[model samples]
Target: MLKKLFGLTASFAALVGLPAGAWAQTAKDADPAIWVVKDADTTIYLFGTVHVLKPGLSWFDEGVKAAFDKSDEVVLEMIEPDAATMQGVIIKAGLSMTGPGLSEKLPKESLPALAVAAKDLGMPESALERFEPWLAAMMSAMAPLSKYC
Candidate 1:
């Protein structure tokens, strides 16, 4: 299945005039990765996506475009929520319901580092107290990447 997908991708790349070394290039110059899964009853091609591209970046061509054009059904990871609705959902689901605050749950030594990171991200350290640990960590992880979007 993998070899067949690669053969099709390579053939399509040639058809579209991409250089043979296209696959060997760095990510900045190459297409995103994709995977194919097949059984007797169904075939699924999974696209690895960044969801948003930097302005002026162009990737929706060649093998990616060909796969999309040939797909029988398209499934997306999400339907984007409106800001207000999204905020409400996060408040409802992403907060600690009845546990020790985030700071209290952490080792005493880690609190200072967490506070520093939160402040550097322009988030009040106290605000993290209301979050579930996973949500807080996710927010911290995603903060730096927000500028890209």
Candidate 2:
């Protein structure tokens, strides 16, 4: 009885722990496009990817497998950084320091809109003001999408 209960509990946990949208689409059915360039001495292939995948998506099938087998290297848009290097980058990017703040630097006319938007998202305007506009915008855009991964 204990063993059966343990097995059921394990299965439940595994199902719950899977990423959201894990069963949305299989690679075989999803038509992702790839660009290829080939010549006598060189071959290049480019494919867009979401950078994460569910466990069962057989994406590297047949043609992709062949191309990967022939390729000497795979290049990614951004290499994964180690923890220390990432921390150093965050510090260098001015995220760690408390300065004059993002409100002061923004044109006086924009502050109200910024505050309203921040409030709508359940974030304090000051929390976002520390980062540059581009970074702040990117973070806001990514907030919803981050949960899936």
lDDT of 1 by residue, 1-149 (tens): 33432332233222223222333223344477879999998888998865434444456558887888889999977665654455556556766658788898878988887887677556668766766766666566555544543
Q: State the lDDT of candidate 2 residue by residue for 61-99, as single tens digits.
A: 466667778889988676646544543454356342466
Give the Cα error of residue 96 in candidate 1, in Å.
2.9
- Model 1 collision count: 0
Candidate 1: pairs in clash: none
Among these predicted structures, which one has the highest TM-score? Answer: 1
lDDT of 1 at 97: 56
TM-score of every candidate: 0.66, 0.56
